[model samples]
Target: MIYVILLTTIVLYAVIAIAIHFRKALHNSNSHQINIQIFRTLFLIVSVNIGGYYLNYFQVLIIIPKLGNDIMAIRKWNQIVGILLNVSAASNAPILYFTSTEYRNAFNKEWQTIIKLLSFCEIAAATSIEQI
Candidate 1:
């Protein structure tokens, strides 16, 4: 049952990501469209990161307690980071959709910060999952 849910979520995300990528490819010559595409990609990345980690959490939570304290801490941390990435990704959508130049510049900076956070979340996911 859980495997079915995880598989569905992953496949759905892959399809969406591919569609977004193709949309970006179609708009390659337009800077505005390209920027929007970049944002879309980032948003999808956030979604995937969150979904993967949360699904992992659900999968392991029952079994992890038996593995002892360190593993549990790692799982909890990954879950929290996944949540943060999701919020950051959602927050970025408005910046892409509705900001003026000055606001866009500031939002761009915020976007950079979010990217860094997302990157860290990816690294954390990779490392922690390895330990698990």
Candidate 2:
């Protein structure tokens, strides 16, 4: 099912992220430690949220179908799970943006380069137009 695929993807990402975190932490640098801690907390929160959502999904889709009752309860649980999942998904971007200085700096550098290129292109265009 789709849930299985989503769960698998999340687990894979978590494993890779944890491995990278550990590798960075092994460096024993203070800044790496701080960044690792921040990312660890974020990963924990997101993992819990995703786990709860998947558990609720499994219960609603698999267990409930067999039981063939408690439809209202399943519906309510699904709604709550859906909301939690959405919140977790939405928070991921902001959490990374705020926590990772390297990411922000790289983004800024790329933006500046883009701006410089655009200005150069504009100047080149203007020169060509004048020559014509």
Give TM-scores for every candidate, taking all chains together and pairing residue i with residue i.
0.32, 0.46
Q: Give one digit per residue, the lDDT tens place, for model 2 in 3-108.
A: 6876786787678677766664445678687757666756765675677667777766786677467778768766776777677656665566666787678778
lDDT of each: 0.64, 0.72
Candidate 2 regions exceeding 4 Å error are 1-5, 16-32, 38-95
Q: Judged by TM-score, which candidate is best?
A: 2
The collision pairs in model 1 are none
TM value for model 2: 0.46
Candidate 1 error regions (>4 Å): 23-28, 35-132
